[model samples]
Target: MSARAALATALDRIERYDEDIGALLEVDAAGAAARAAELDRSESHGALHGMPFVVKANMCIEGRIASCGSRMLEGYRAPYTASAVQRLIDEGAVPIGIANMDEFAFGSSGENSSFGSTRNPWDLSRAPGGSSSGSAAAVAARMVPFALGSDTGGSVRQPAALCGVTGYKPTYGVVSRHGLIAFGSSLDAVGVLATSAADVERVLAVISGADERDATSALRAPFEPAPARTDLRGLRVGLPREYFPADLDGRVRQPLEQALDDLRRLGAELVELDLPTTRHAIAAYYVVATAEASSNLARYDGVRYGARIAGDGSLQGMFAATRGAAFGAEALRRILLGTYVLSSGYYDAWYLRALKVRRAILRDFQAAFERVDVLAAPTSPTPAFRLGEKLSDPLAMYLCDVLTVPTSLAGLPAISVPCGCAAEDGVELPVGLQLIGPAFEDARVLSVARCYQAATEHHRRLPPLVAGGVA
Candidate 1:
């Protein structure tokens, strides 16, 4: 299909289905159509030639609104396009619009968005996962072939798992973070969500590399192209015992075990290993992440970026009033938590110890890598939960990152692939099998996911919302 036709089809699906799903915060039909028309006239373009995609609202596209699903920057327009996004646009990919995300990329479930939570396409009553909620939902609902997301914790992978799409978080520094709105800058990495790992691979190829704009971006070779075959012969896969807590739901466990069997059948050897620091990951992650968030978010004071509140008060009072009015409950909660951890007396006890724990987590992964090529585990403890299910319970929501955050903290590469579905309330909710690899080994991760996807048709399965509407 031509780019124009594809854009029209995508817009039609969004209009038809997004009312209930709430996947998109904004749609640039006019911009996408104009770009598509221009591509149609050109005789030649680049790899993504006329393809349409969505970016998580946190990513800046010059002159476009990037609300990041929060009121703080509600009408903020990016003065320049994000470097990674610019690379894709350079290769002929058209940006359709911005996808929803947890406000400031802070929440685990999509419900944290100030605008409204993005519903899971599998069952509209449930959350799609987050903070890349809209990115995953848009892909799952078939409104776009792929979308860009940011993973700070399991923002990309968890949502992809819940929404039944392929989501990948490349090694930290593999993709530049020049324009991503900061949320735990140390843990944040640009990621992709799509129907298959192969599609994610293609998008990564075009955008992965160092950028001068981002000091943290590494100077590295372009990722080796994905292998042509899905064979996993002689590949070593590890199973981290900590990832499978005794309390894990059978619905999620069963599919994960079945996926392991699928990998074994594909000629991969499974090794049982231990990441001893896994249990401490969640605690350490929160301290470090929130502390950094507190530091980074200080720039958003009402005097500058965020919406200013005109209250009758002194400068200090105005700062308090503006921030109080602009930031959401979750955002305020995080900032306070962050501030407390970084306070003078508590800094050494909480913040310093968290850094030590973070190092321990990294070392654990390094030790495990010595024995295995890739590690496999469940992406989440359960399938998509009802909208309000865990929202009231902050601790429960934080635990959703239990299985996925270790890899993020270690700066390793990981991908979430739909393994199978667990029946829930008379409907089958998708469960994801996560694959983790050592830093800079993104190709192997993608190859492993592709192999599993080929042996099983899980990734090909679409939610009824899109399947039933297809003409």
Candidate 2:
């Protein structure tokens, strides 16, 4: 199909289905169509030639509004595109628009977005997960072929799992963060959500590698295409005992166990392993992530960036007014907690201690790597939950990410692929199976996910919303 045709088709779907789902925060329809037309006239198409995609609101795109799904940046226009995004453009991917996200990438559910929560495509009453909520929902809804989201903690993977699509979080330094608005600098990663692992891999190859702009970006080998196989052969898969606890929902537990059986039948060895420090990951991740968030978010004074609110009296007054008015409740809660931990008297006690815990978690993962090629686990404790189910309880909402946060804290690469389905409220919701690899082992992780996808039709299964409307 011509680039313009593809762009047109995606735009039409968004117009038809997005009103109920709220997957996009902004739609650059004219820009995308114009670019698609131009690409159609090109003599040679790049790797992604004419494919349409979406970017999370937090990532910058020159001349486009990068709202980060908050009132603070609601009117802000980006002066430059993110390096990762620019690279994709060079390969012929046309950005459709900015997908919604938790304000400043904070909450575990999409409810934290100032623009409103993104509903799960499977069931509009349920959350799609966050802070990559909109990106995951858009892809799952087939509003776009794929989308980019930043994963800090379980922002990307959790949503992808909940949305029943493939979400790939690259190694910490593998993708540059020059344009992603900082939430947890140390834990943040630019990730991709798409219908299949191969599509994620295609985008990953284009966006991966070093950038002089981002000091933390690594000089890694660019992605190369390869043949995939379903046979596991000599691969050893580790099941972290802590990830499958007794408290896990029965719906989620059953599908994941069956997936293990599938892998076993395909010639993979499943070994149970213990990552003793897993219990402490949530506490430590919150401290370290919030501490960095508190520091990074300090720049949003009305005078410097974002929307400004006139002060009643002084400069400090203006600062407080702007942030207080612009930031959502969840964002403020995290900021307050982060500031408290980083406070003078509490820094050593809370921040420093969390760092120690982080180190221990990393070491635990490193030790596990010595024995297993990849570690597998449920992506979330349950499938998509009702939108308001955990919104009123922040602690309960945070616990939703329990299964995916440890690898995130360790800066490891992880991919979430649909393993099976669970019936919730009489609707069959998708359950994700996550495969985590050691740092920078993104390729291996994607390979395993692609192999599973090839062997099963899970990833090919579309949500009722998309499937019903598409034909």
Count the clashes in each prediction.
Answer: 0, 0
Candidate 1 per-residue C-alpha lDDT over 1-471 given as tens digits, one digit per residue, 9 for 90 to 100: 688888888899899989989988889999899999998888887889877899999999998888889899998989899999999999989999889889999887889898999999999999999999999999999888899999989999999999999999999999999999888889999999999988999899999988999999989866666666667889999999998878889999999999998999999999999999999999999898899999988887788676888676778777778888888888898899999999999999999999999999999999999999999999998899999999988889999999888888888999999999999889889999999999998998998888788889999988987788864
- Clashing residue pairs in candidate 1 are none
Q: Candidate 1: where is the Cα deviation over 4 Å?
A: none
Scanning candidate 2 in windows of ten residues, the lowest lDDT window is: 221-230
lDDT of each: 0.91, 0.90
Against the hidden reference, what TM-scores do the models get? 0.98, 0.98
**Steric clash count of candidate 2:** 0
Off by over 4 Å in 2: 225-227
